[model samples]
Target chain A: MNNRQILSAAIGSLLALGLVSNASAAGKKMDMEQCYGVAKTGHNDCSSNKSAHSCAGQATKDRDAEDFVAVPKGTCAKIAGGTLKSA
Target chain B: MEKPANDSLPCIAGIGLRAPHYCEVLEKLPKLGWVEVHNENFFGGGASLRTLLKVREHYPVSLHGVGMGLASTAPLDQAHLSALCRLCDAVQPAAVSEHLCWNSVPDMTINGPMVINDLVINDLLPFPYTQEALSHVARRVDQVQEKIGRRLLVENLSSYLSFTSSEMSEGEFLSELSRHTGCAILFDVNNLYVNARNLGVDAKAFIKALPAEAVAEYHLAGHSIRDGCLVDTHSTQVCAEVWELYEFALQHIGPRPTLIEWDSDIPVLAVLTGEAEKAQQRLEEYHACFK
Candidate 1:
């Protein structure tokens, strides 16, 4: 198979394996080929962001905008407090 | 007494050989009396162990352990002890030592580089030196000696807090433990200095109380200041004050295999060699006085 066909098959296997739990699992689903194309474009756009935080924030915003999931505020602060301490 | 094969630990000074300078040291083969490395870092058979063996060919090696937790309430880690025994057989280290403090508890928790915390976060947790704790540590020390087939040296630890329940001072505890188990002491002069400043422990008295025959080695390292307390950080150059305290220890304790240790933000080989040179100078000065 060509590269595009191989990529499509890998994405199909992941989705079939129920690995993409963060995304919507209901309603009529997009085929693997379509999902792969969308992901590739989204990744290119995210990489252009100035900082990792901006990229992650934009990704979360996009996911929420698409009704993928709810993004909570100040989650980073809570995680930082729980993890950072002296050894 | 007949020295062990490959035994060359000078009654002078040496450096804690770290990964950053292993290649350069092997190539140059600097005029060092001996070198020490953390035993855990070389437990696995890999490049690190390979390099240490190469370095071992040139200088006497001392395996200083930081994770044995001899006083831990938990059952002794048989795997850790086994790894140490295997490394000893392979390296034939001139000496092997562990700290006097406890790092593991009944819950199998640990502290320090493997685990970090502000208080009781599993890393080298200090406890009250009660009679029960002393017996626990003595039993563990006995097990280690039996397993390793050699007398183990235990070093004193630096602490941020003191226990209200401690029945005796740390020096007294160490002396008693040595008396009971026949373990040698790896006296770290910088740790004594830190304890003296932070907890108001009298360093001179502690030094005087120690059984001189039980001392097998000496360690000198730098520490950092934190909120009016001295922390045994071992990052920077050996401070002037610690050097002076080391001189006092040399005078009292007599000549031992002194090691210069710098763990964090390690500098160039020249910098560590320079530090080792300073320790060598001090050891020589003490010898001169005896003459």
Candidate 2:
């Protein structure tokens, strides 16, 4: 089947499953969408936070506090490349 | 009215629609109250956006975000925000949500997806719970809500370590944030369980602290243990302990849209449906009380 046919079948089957009715499916706001890195510690959002689950402990070498780029909202704005809106 | 109109999703359970099971789920159309997906995956539409539109024809899709860290120290990535807004316009999602953690740091730059910004960390990094941080987060959340033209539900983060400079607990911070920004809470049960185990946070107190009416959705996920601390790994099945905590949350906050979140090492469609079914059973028990 073509794309429209495939989508039609999918929506039809979804209705058949009683998961979503045609009325509600059409009516609903019909919405809606990882990593970790250096400067990243045990957490990434993965196994920890990035490594939180998926890449747990990928970067275990603890960096000193100075390695982190995080500053207060004020200082962050003053940094050369830290404009709120990028060029 | 018979029952006060509750705009939240049905009390039944749903699953996180991951890349692995997309074809199967779309083909089979398994029984689920709703389905959620990461917002970044569909940033610039192509086949992925096309598929999501078709999926939208079926299930109630929730736009759950991982990259839009509300507490990030960097300036709000308007490009990223615009991409999210475009996706929401196309999808008209049932609920739009993001993690309370901060991921945007200017240590690196993202080169793709129309993000005209310097480097942003790919991970969900933790932040201190100072008053300053809370104000920053509330303002950022307000920006997102205004852009989306809808209330954004903020999910609590699961961290391995605690910051020494933190002035308040994560739960209290979230409570105050809701009061300030009118943002709803996503209430990830697994994150709370992981934090309780790793950082000695009071799980019961965390649940008690949240504004119940502010909670828009509930997430149940599996985790793994490393060294001594529990990791919020969404790899395995939802553990028994988290199920108990979820039920406890239901008792306290009442039922809302519940989702089973299995991210990495995603299992087959059947496995996710099975987990969703288990949650559905608990929801039935919760719904009986309103009868």
TM-scores of chain B, in order: 0.90, 0.92
The Cα error of candidate 1 at residue B8, in Å, is: 6.2
RMSD of each: 15.3, 15.0
What lDDT score belongs to each candidate, Candidate 1 first?
A: 0.75, 0.78
The positional error of residue A86 in candidate 1, measured at the CA in angstroms, is 35
Chain A of candidate 2 scores what in TM-score?
Answer: 0.23
User: Compared with the true structure, what per-residue lDDT tens digits does model 1 show for residues A24-48?
Assistant: 5541253332322322445522422
Best-performing candidate as measured by lDDT:
2
Model 2: residue B232 alpha-carbon error in angstroms:
1.4
Q: What digit string (tens of lDDT, one per residue) describes model 1 on residues B164-211?
A: 999999999999988888888889888888889999999999998888
- lDDT per residue as tens, model 2, B1-291: 021222356667998876556566666787889998888877785546766777889898998887887888788889989999999999988888898887766544355544544556777778889999999998999899888888888988889878999999999999999889888899999988988988899998899778998887899988887677787778889998999999999999888788998876778788998999999899888874332
Query: Model 2, A87: alpha-carbon shift in Å?
Result: 44
TM-score of each: 0.71, 0.73
